[model samples]
Target: MQSAIPVSSVWRRPVSPLHCRCEEGDLDLVVIGAGYQGLSTALHAARAGLSVQVIEAGGIGDGASGVNGGQVIPGLKQDPETLLALFGDEAGRRLIEFSAGTADFVFDLIAREGLDVEHTRSGWIQAAHTETAMQAAVQRNRQWRAQGADVALLNPAEIALLTGAEGYRGGFLDRRAGVVNPLALVHELARIATEAGAALLLNDAATSLQREGTFWQVSTRSGRSFRARKVLVATNAYSEGLVPNLARSLVWLHSFQIATEPLPPDFDFILPSGQAVSDSRRIVLYYRRSADGRLVFGGRAPMRVPQSTDDWLHLERAMRRLFPMLGSMRIEQRWFGRVAMTPDYMPHLHEPQPGLLMAAGCQGRGIGLMVALGGVLARYLAEGSREALPLPISPLVPIPLHRFRRLGVAAHLAWYRLLDGLER
Candidate 1:
């Protein structure tokens, strides 16, 4: 007998969130935040035979890592030539190599770990919204291909046929990229991390960090104090007071998504290629097909949480504009998550105090980058070497006038929208 209540496509077995402490004195590492970076770090550290622990403020899948649209895109906001010019020959080449392989790295890990996250490495699209955008895509495809990446160019006809969307001039596709069940990935990581001897404490926020003798002491909201030889602070746009203005350093923006219930069988042609897409617009449009055949569409949202339906009307309009076959599909889910964007659109590694390390700035490309970074971080932590890290360690510098970012972001979004219209 079918139950009256509808079940979600992705099955959930929530982790038992309880207050737990590390095992005994002077642990090797105490990680704050249980997002991809923290989980990856703990898993790798534990596998390496290091004593480690994780402290999460909320339940798993509460941050950007879990709630995202699951697009595993590789590369940074900068192109190869620009990166080379900015950071010279050696460093730029290293950064390029690291960014290019993030997606493959993530897919390999999923297979290697036997993670239950449903995923594919079919490809990822960068739809060109304008002729100029097409030219840029062409250049990007050429650059990556020359570096031995499996990338290709698509014509207007190919773009329209592949995406089932209107008004795309051309595009680029990276065959190494793909999509995943984001929350499922996080849950599996948590499960495996705990099984590997990394203690995970959920709902226990790290409220304070201070040095106690040689070890760094982390004080939690539950009045529990943990001491460790090192600390990893994973920044996911929700960081705050624990580390002195760490939150202000990022430009936090909201990216929201709406998903339809499993569509009728005939709608399979909508994204028949089974590749996730993000277009080349100032305010980008990204969408994908879920494992259960729902259309999971997403785009720029208000800087804050939605207070009314008006905040999401733009997505519906855009969806209908792209794929007009559906007159009125009922949206089964509407959700949003905060993204920490850097002004330069590059990832940063910081060491604010002795024995404390942190990473910031995902810029909407967090999925694969953050996961791949885990091995980098784990190796660095285990062996005490900085040679493999892409970004140099630096002090956390707050973004200037972060208090006024609300007004600036709102105004800029409006202006960018107007500019997008003018381009057409």
Candidate 2:
């Protein structure tokens, strides 16, 4: 009735990564990292006729951008009421409004750029694994709908009808949520940026950064140096020793995904509407149909960095449990990526020094949120005013005893898993 196949593999991107030859020149902005955020910044900056250059350690979308679940869900990691309570009324409202439209912003960008990424706006289902969890989904629908979000509470039957899965109790559907090929999306943005005169260099990592008078000098591992008036560090979960105390400020967690071979054409009832779906649990479970009819499913990774497909046995078991119809469907691929989680489970914009801007700690909700934040950061840089930003800029605060983050995360996962089991 179930399988434990561990065929670790990488998703072959539609296009090869760009390898632009760097030139010796200064730029208006230097974006470090070619993920969604950095490339998005480059796109907006290049569109405004600014000299932009993006430096990436590996190929474009080599990091989490290539391996993410690709669910274009809206809002921050925290709920609306929680954000409202933490940030107060006016600022909270602004943050809610901005975050709610992140998916819309992404789809809009795709249509505007005529990018051929396999994107769909068939809505997103947040399924509840338990009746108790369904109550929370009800609250979420109320909170989001009050902010003008097109969300509705779904009964258990509705959940089953929408997802083709019977185990879920109930949940909510956000009309704006969707999915896309993250690799394709990032590559398209990179193409747009380069065509708009922005320089993008892959296989290049910013080794060191220093400020001199009014400009910042960035040295790459390939021995090339570039100077820029403004520096934007968008290297989220992959920020390993890139900047002082940057990596230490966030807890890095591993998220893994597994894909099944294309379901038989006759099995059309499974996610028939083609909407992306995720369950409401501390360790989130998400799945969607690929353009080729495969089921791209994902969930939490092991406490440690996952090495092989076998390391994602939990996800395999979860998938089989939810959809028993796949009695022996072969798992075609397995991959994992790191997610930068802030203590508060929210994104942070840091301006630790003048002319330097760093944004990170997405807490596993990056797809749409990353692009939205990138646009906001680009505008803030051009306007040279923090007042123009939807979220306030804050100083970097490194977590105390950050060396034990891995152990702490292990404990956190254990507790969350325990709670999830009890609730279920």
Candidate 3:
């Protein structure tokens, strides 16, 4: 296994600051947020001959796009059968096909861009935490297999061999899924977008957005204004209050992860096949072996932004439960990222107003979904074809009483944790 470059260190990797005029001007698209979606959309849109400008409140990928678990898991939380049943044929099939190809699209982009980074496509394992979960995996396997996905069910013995964890009963693997240093990919995407002629305004946040005449005028906190024909709010989980329509559309949660100090022998024991492993618990825990020989272990975290490392120690108990040998290992990295969840556990594309597009809720699979969706958005914007979109542009209704969402999520996580513990 290759060594994973320290994720924290990547934050300091010198991406040249935008040397050109930082002024806001006429543009085809003014994308808010420089995470995966914004960078990808900006890259594609610029290539498609659209004048693009991206505004970021902080450094690129400073949000979940860089800090996430980096597991390139595919599809929505819903299984193929459920998707078909819930969405019906046309929309369901489109969703299924779009999701199935997300992982491929991400890896393809990495390759096409000639990104020199450590990545693997060995597979992704959904290690079942209980017999019921194993049964669920079996059904998912059957459904996805029937849909021509390269998937298979793994028995307990196979699960142990693959995950190197003891508690999992069994699970299934998706060969199409994998892992990569997300920060590497996203930071590189920023470079690619810049090279493609997209203006990147780092450390600048969009404050207000309004329609004036034919163009949308986006005012930044730094007193810069950009007029664009279209706008995309790709902030995802980090959507604070720049636009209430997008900020209130989804629920936000935090996912924290800890990395062991270059556990090489542990890597030999855990996830030797290079497959990222995530359990089937409702409050799911996911782990992957980084190229730097670190085991990135993570699950649910505080519903709100963590105050410090004290907020992350809660995971040690669960970590030792799965791999008790880790009980004595030194944790070198502790971090958490924001997660956006929709009520339906599916991604949403909202057109709250004309020429203003919003995308949210990849339900933790944003890496692959956003990467692919970027191209789709680019094509759609380039051709003005709404019918070609796999996702429907639905109405923007703010989740009711979103101010109390944190308390509600904390309660739900507690209940789910109790239920998950009972199964164990």
Q: Model 2 segments beyond 4 Å from truth?
A: 1-12, 16-19
Q: Which stretches of candidate 1 lie over 4 Å from their true place?
A: 1-21
What does candidate 3's lDDT look like per residue over 1-424, in tens digits? 0122332422223344443335345888988888888888989999999999889988766788888888898887899889989889998999899899999999998898887556899989999988898999999999999999999999999999887788788999999999988877888888888988988888888999999988899998888889999999998887877776677788988888888888756359788889998899989889888878878889987775666567777687788889886769888877777889998888888877788888899787888999889989888877879866888888877898888888888899999988988899
| Model 2 C-alpha lDDT per residue in residues 140-212, reported as the tens digit of each score | 9998888888899989888888888767888889998998888788888888878777888888789999998
TM-score for each of the candidates: 0.95, 0.95, 0.94
Clashes of 2: 0
Q: Which residue runs does candidate 3 get wrong by more than 4 Å?
A: 1-25
lDDT at 308 for candidate 1? 60
Reference-based lDDT, residue 303, model 2:
50
